[model samples]
Each structure stands twice: as structure tokens, then as C-alpha cells.
Target: MMTERSIREAKAGDKAFILWDSQIKGLGAKIFPGGEKSFVLSYRVNGAKRLSTIARVSELSLKAARERAGQELVRIRSGETDPLERRREAREAPTVNDLWDRFLTEYAPERITLGRMTTGTLKDYRNQAHRYLLPVLGRMKVRDVRRTDIERMARIMAHVPVQRNRTLAFASRLFTVAEHWSLRANYTNPCRGVVRAREEPRDRILSDSELAALGKTLTSLADRYPVPVNVIRFASVTGFRIMEAAGIQWSNINFERGCVTLPQTKVGRQVRALPPAALELLKSMPRINDCDFVFTTTGKVSVAYKHLDEVFKMVCQKARIENVRMHDLRRTVATTAAGQGVGLTVLRDLLGHKTVQMAVRYARQADSAVAAAVEQTGGNIASAMGVKPKAKIVHIRKRRHG
Candidate 1:
């Protein structure tokens, strides 16, 4: 019912009115310079107000906008109003990487170590996002992302179950940042409904023969790179993370107390008691005049990032071990402690695990001792049952073939 003449006459004050454009049929231009464009129809939606534009003016004609508005109004009158909710839903969604950056800037710097763990986590997020999420939704507005896209990415990661699950978990936490930063208004995470891949089992315990070979290889490497060799050896004995071991300062050790104080770890600050073997190893290392670190690469408490990878790779190759990693040394320490009948609570404190489940992993690794008992019994079930075990053997095996 709105015509160009009536529209002009109806514009009494600063209020906006629609003018029909002859270039396009059913096209009504909003005369207001800064206001939402909506279709002018015969009746209002729910008799409340005129239905707004179905799409942007750049994309939809006035005719198309009018058609969409009419359809929406028909639904509105039926008490089925979901278009606004749908628009809100799309705008509330955001990707995991979006929230991760917020967490990194707001929380991580103040609370966590800036060494390998933090850097490694950021690196992992970048790699995973680039590999999967970025490809699909990088250019999409964070608030406009859809749950279907997230679910599809999860399905694609099924080929790598462990990494997939980890990636999803990371996404879940990253998206959780929206609640804090107000990047998105919604409280729900998009990954909340997505199915995660199954956790893959890894029985990565090293056997006795493997340990002997590794010891020999480490001894040989001592001639070439004594510092890193000692570092690896110390890590194996103490169960400290490589970065923590590398960052160990003289101030952290107490020869008299027979314990090392770690002011901070991956989870938080903790104290670890040095066993006799580890204590002796610390004593054997040469002390420097001004250096504070127990292991110094360039006269500092922290090791140089570049040299660590080379040293670790060379030692693994020499030991004929494939896939043996620096973190496994922490596992070795936990396994050894568990074999000594250390309780899960004590082990959790020693390793600075925030959760008991992490300590349980070490217990599971120590469970290989059952196999050792079976071997000693010569496969005799009754012999295994009656005899008291003489000694706990935690064998660390090296792979013979690289």
C-alpha cells in the first residue's frame, strides 16, 4: 500500500519511510541513511511490527526480501517464531582457536611457565587448527560458525584417535573462554555435542634388555655430549619432565635434605625427593662458579631450544630406539616409583599431577611387573602365588631396530 508519493508525504519528522525504486519490481528502498532495511508488506508480523529484511540489501532484491518477510510473517502468526533465534544461534557460535588466544593472553601468561609446555601447547593449537579447522572455517566469522562444521572436523580427525580426542578436548576448553572474554554471548560450547574419537591404548613400557642397551648407548654418548647425556640420565632416574630437568637450578637442590624443590611444574609448584642414585648423579656433575642451573647449556638455568632436539634424536638413534621421547623419561621415573610400592597420592605429589588419574597411568605402566613375576615363576601359576618377590625389577627396554 506504500507508494513513493505517500512515502515522501508520510515522512513528517526524522522518522524513516520506504520509497519504491523503479529499477527493480517490488523493490522498496529504506530512505534512512543508517537504519535496517525491511520489506514493506500488507500486514505486520503477529500484528506487532513490520517483518525486517530477509537478507542484506547487497544480496537480496526488495522482491526477494518481501517474499521472505511474508513467509516469516505467516509462520509468526502460527506461533512458530524461530528466525530471530536462528540468527542469534549462528552469531553465538565460535571456534576453539578463538577462545584459546583469549586464554593465552588473559590467563596462561600469569599462571603457567613460558618454557616448553606453554610454547608446545600453542604450537599444537596452531598446527591442529591449520590442519583441520582453519581450512574449513578460518575466514568464517567466529560468531557465525556452525556446530555442523565442528562435528565434521571431529569426524575427520578419527584417523588419528588420540590426537583427535586431544584436539577436541582442546577445542572444548578454548571455546569455554567465550564465557570469560565475552567473545560470544552463548554459554554453550559448539564441541559439547560432537562425538570424540576413542582413546588409543599404548603399552610403551621399556623392558630390562632395552634398558641395558639404552644405558650402554647413553654411556657412549657421554663421550661426545656429556651435558645432554647426563641430562637424559638424570631425567630417567628422577622422572622429571625434560624442561623441568633442564631448568633445574642449584638453588632447587638440597644435598643435606636429600630432596629437590621445584618451585613450579606443568601442574604447579612441587617438591621431589631425590633417590640415592639421582643424588649421586647430581654430585658427579661439575659445578660452575656463577651458574645456578644444575644443567646449563649456555650458562643459564634453561637449555637452548635448538640444541635439545638434536641431542635427543642422536641419543635415540644411538640407542636404537624409535619413538622413545623425552616425556617417556617422566614415565620411567613414575614406573620406577610405582614398582617401589609408592602410593598414588605420594606419586601424584611427587610428579605434581593435579589429578590422580595421571598417577594411575604410572601405576598401569608398573603393572608390567606382573609379567616380570610370571617370567621369574617360569610360567608356573602356583609358584607365582606362594613365593615372596625378592626384588622389584623395572626394566626399560630400547628398540633394537631404528
Candidate 2:
């Protein structure tokens, strides 16, 4: 039993001794050898027993201490709150790294992307964190992150505008994932207001002359470096994105159907229609060492990124082409197809674009082919309507669209 008078006269021992109160099951006075005394509350919360120090005996009378203990015990019995968890959280808020770790290990793999992210998305996220985000803001508490931090990161990597924007996007997502994980106290996504640099869409299309020169160069390289030439020619003719070209396996090619079924694309699985020229090109490629991939330099493995880039650069130099990228060849095909009066929907499907809006850019290039198509469409419409040859609609005029 512990009273105000008895607590004062209590002698300190070699170690701490807990003096339990007879009236209260959980109320006690902890007397230490150092002459310190404190009130404690013992109770079970949600099936777990808890022994929590309420206050120093000097701060409150024994009566008050007992009442406080009673209140805490009552609250725990009624299932109101758990102070232990709240205390733990306040003491140990997760850092950005902690949240990212869970994202890599648990969340990313379990998440249902429905075919948006690449197979390498997890690896890419880790690489992004290691290369950029982690170095600048890894140690900061997730709850304390602000929009200014993301914007500051953008300015830091302004030299690499693309990577800067990408980092901002990825960091903003950290908060989104953290909210569900309860990693941070704050719910606001910090990347909302970070201004991204204006980036010019790389829509560079190869001209006919440039294409002819490239074809000649590729033909010359065909004997010496056959694989690189075939890869370039296949991509140029089929309008496949660089990876879509590089990652193609013989299994993906359906000779009977005259199309390649890509199991994993940027958006999802897609089937690209191959023209007669492209089919003939695929037919001409030689198989190597039982490797499934159609575009491998080594019989056992795919061509290295550096090796592919080096050879492509050499081919471009031989063609006397300046600043033309591998992806530009794809744009050239889209533009040429559009100019030849290929409909927007057809073009979208052909390029594996997610929406027709993405294909609208090609509409701006109204070349002679499109102009000729407009004349043909108008004349056909006039004939279908039973209009005379001299009708006012027979003359083809410039319109907003083909």
C-alpha cells in the first residue's frame, strides 16, 4: 500500500521497488534507489498487457494519481484508444527510404497495373531512387516533405530536363503510396505545383532523300554487319519503337498472319501489321545459335545497348544525316502513312497508340498525298450524290482536315 505520508518516508533501496496500492489493481508508486518516485498505470489494451508510467508522484497527489489510473484503465476496458501505438508512431515516423523500400518489395509487385508499366518498372524505380531522389532527400521524414523540395530537385537537375521531370513525377507518387501505407502523418502530394520545363516533342521525320541515303548505307553495311542493318531496316519499315524492334523474337512473328504479336508493349500487348516489304525483310534474316530473339548480334544474347548505338551512329554518319534519332524513323513512317491518306483510327492502331489524340499530330502534315486524297474523296462523294460533272463541289479546296 502507498499513501502520501508512507510514500514520503519510503526508503530508497539498492534497486527500484514498485509499491502497489491496495485500492487500485493497476495503480502503483515506483520508488527508485536514486530517491525518485512515479505513478504508473497497468492495464490490458486489445488483449496486450501494458504497463505505462502515468506521472511523477511529486506532480500529483496519491488521490489524483489513483483517479488518473482508474480513468486510463476504464478507457482501455471500453476500447477507446491505444496510447502505445500513437506514442510509437510519434517517436518513429518513416523516412522516404522506408516507404520506397516497401514500395519495391511489397506494393509494386502486388499492384494491378493492367498493363501500363514495363516489366522493368520496379528496377527503373530503384535506379531512379539510387541515382537521383535518394541522394538529395532520402533522409528526410516523409511527413515533412514539401513541394519546394520537389521543385528544388527539378532545378538541380534542370540540365537533364527529362530526368528532372521524371524524378518529380516519381517522388510525388511516393506520397500517394505512403498514404495507403500510413507511413506519414501528412496526406498532401508534394509534387503538385512543381513546374516542369517545357520539352519539345521529338517528332523529327526523315525526308525521302535522307531515307534513300540511309537505305543505301544500310545496304552497304548489310554484308559486313548484317544484324544491325536488318534491325535498322525492320524498324524503319515496320515503324516499331526501338525496343519493340530489338526485343522481337521469332515466336512473335506470325508468317501466316503477316503481323508480329508483341506480348509486352509500353501500354499492353499489341499486334503490329507487317507490310509485304517488312515480311520479305523478316524472311531474309538468318537465325543464330537457337537464340529466340530475331535481333541478336551474338548467337547466345541480345546486342548490347552501347554496341547497337555505336553501329547506328556509324550508319547515320555514313548517310550524312545529322541529329536523327532511332525513334525518328518511327515518326517518319507515321507521317508518311498519314500523308498517304491512312485514316486516323488506322494510324492509331498501326502505331499501337492508346488513343486517336496521339495520332492527331500527323494531321498537321497535309502533303500532296493527302491533298490528292481530298480531291478523290470529294469527287467520289459528288458522283455518289448523283451531282453533274460541273457541280461546284468538284473543285477541291483547302479544308480544316483531309
Candidate 3:
């Protein structure tokens, strides 16, 4: 008898009352003055009358709520059953939120995923859950959730496809943790068949002119924004992710070996060798006597995230570079290093990529070098076949200078 509007309007007075379903005998929705509505089934336990809540209004649709109430009524009428205790025991089943707590406390710390879970990963997870999962699936019992729920989450489109894919990935991992926790009613993960948004690999790299401009801008900002400039220069050569560079400590730097070691990294924690240029830049940076961090104003751990972002933005604006993020420096380093004939293994280690395939993905800005190699091969082939090499034809487009 509860329509959406009626349920919304339903309020309790000074006294409590159940608005029993007209069609169903004992099935009713209990309303409290506090505005909580729940589907409940009234049945007799032994000789005593007992009422057990089926589910919350938000958790189940009206039809599904009635159906659950009906099921509870039928179960009680059937010969030897304690419906109250059964539902009471069923109350112990964790909701998605509860399982999420357990996931953070138990599953994540053990590094159960494909790789090590960093603090940054946990922070991302916490933020993703805060923004996405808990808001959608908080009320649903973890066991009761079907594939459709996960599909619903995946369907939430973002302006960028990466955000949607990341939400899906976070959901998938939650389901995996739920499965490992053995909390799901169905053994299969809801995330398995759900189509996630495709993510394009970011290919932002600074050109020679842009790099020169950036260097000059950083040099100018050295007095005002000393920490970020040095860190930015360090990352340009070392390919350090913003967080990796942010987390750099004086103790991690091995000047003798010309390297910086990250005790904990996104992938496997490893040492990254610095070239003479990066080493010289590191040496040039003035160290604070009491501070342990390579980048800090308070001499605590590192510069505040917002401070780093603001300084970087200011530097970019000063450099006259449009649409350049801090991460592009890492990509620029990788592409430049690869073009300079740096080996894949060295790139993999230097960039802290878990695999060579990931390293290879970063080493993909060698079109000119590759074209030159192909030209040499073609010339050698033509000479062996006694064919004369054709004269090169070049086309140049004139730029409009302001």
C-alpha cells in the first residue's frame, strides 16, 4: 500500500503505528517519528507474536520489499521455524560500507592486489569511495548486490574517460575484496562482465623550445619557489612522478653512486640512478640543516600538495606554456631518454615501471630516429640490388610569426 509519495509523506506521531499492506495479511511498513521506514513481517514465534524487519525502504524497491515481507511470512507459517532469530542472525551480514572498512583494515594492508599498495593508492581509494561507492552502495547489503549495481556505477560517465575507468577499477577491486572476504551471496564478482570506459594513454611531452622555456621559468622562480624548481629540474632528468619527487629525502640520495633510492614506490620500491646532470642539479640545491626532505618550506616532510600545484601553475604561466601538467615532465624525460638511445631495462628501472612493457610505452617518441634507421636499411637494400638511391624530396611549411 506504500507508494513513493506516501512513503515520503509517512510520518509518525507521538505514538507508533504500522501501515499494514491491504493485499498482504501481516506484511507492513513500519514508520518511526525519526523518518525511518522499514518493511516488516508480523509472525508468531512459538505462542508469542513477533515482528521482524525485512529490509529498509531505500535498500529495496516497494515490490521487492513486499516480496521479502511475503517470503518471511511464508517461512514463519511453514512447520518448525524461528523467523525472528533467522532474520536476527541475517542482521550480522555486513553492508558494503562495513565490508569497505574491513577491506581497508584487513585486505589492503596485506598487498593482495597485483602489486604493492602504496599510501597514495589507499588515499585514491579513500577519495574514490567518498565520491562514488559509499554514496551509491552504502545501504545495500554486500551479499545482495547484483551485477546491475556495479554496472550502474560504471555507467556514471565523466568528462574524461580515465575517471570513469578508475571508478570501475576501484569497484572491481572492492568486489574482489568482498569475494575474498566471502561476504557475497553469489560467488562471482559483479565487476567481471561490466564494460568499463576505455582510457587513452597520456602522451604529453615537452618540445625542445617548451623545455628551454620551462627551464628558464624554473630558474627565475628559484628564489621565490626554490623547492619546486629544483624538484622539477630533478624530475625532468630522472622521470620521477610528482609524488615520488615530493617524497624525496636527503637520506635517500646516494651521491657516491649518483642515484636516489625510493624506499617505497608506486610499483616495486627500487633505486633510480641519476645522470651527471641530475646529480649536479641535486648538488646545486641548498639543503636545510634541520630538514630531512629534499623539498620543504616548513622543513617537515614535503611541500604541501596545493603549494606545489600553485607554484607549478605559476611557473607554467610565466613560461607561456599552455596546458602543461607536472606529470608531463616525467613523460618528457622518458621520451627524451629513449630518443637518446637509453636501453629499455634502464628506462624500466629509472622510471620505476613494474614491467618492461610499461617502460616501452613511455619510450615512444623516436619517429625521426626510426625514420632515419628505415632510410639506412632501404639504402643498403637498394645498393645490394644495384638500384640508384632516389634524391630526397622535402616539404616545409612556413610559420606565421606574430
lDDT agreement with native, every candidate = 0.68, 0.81, 0.79
Model 1, residue 16: what's the lDDT?
A: 71
lDDT string for model 2 (1-402, tens) is: 678988888889999988889998978888889999998877776577887888998899999988888887787778767556656775688788887888877777665365656755555677779988888788888887888887766777888887777777778787888877766545588887778876656657788899999999999988888877788888899888877887788988999989999887866888889999989988988899899888788887666556667778999999899999888888889889888788999999989998999888876653644676788898899789997676444545565432
Clashes of each: 5, 0, 0
**What lDDT tens digits, residue by residue, belong to model 1 across residues 227-290?**
7877778888777788777777787899998988877665556778887888898898777757
- Candidate order (lDDT): 2, 3, 1
- Model 2: runs farther than 4 Å from truth? 1-87, 90-92, 111-114, 120-124, 185-187, 366-402
* Cα-based lDDT at residue 334, candidate 1: 82
lDDT of 1 at 292: 85
The alpha-carbon lDDT assigned to residue 43 of candidate 2 equals 74
Off by over 4 Å in 3: 1-82, 110-115, 368-402
Selected candidate, larger TM-score, 1 vs 2: 2
Residue 183 alpha-carbon offset, candidate 2, angstroms: 2.3
Global CA lDDT computed for model 1: 0.68
Q: Candidate 3: lDDT of 55?
A: 81
RMSD of 1: 9.2
C-alpha TM-scores of all predictions:
0.68, 0.69, 0.72
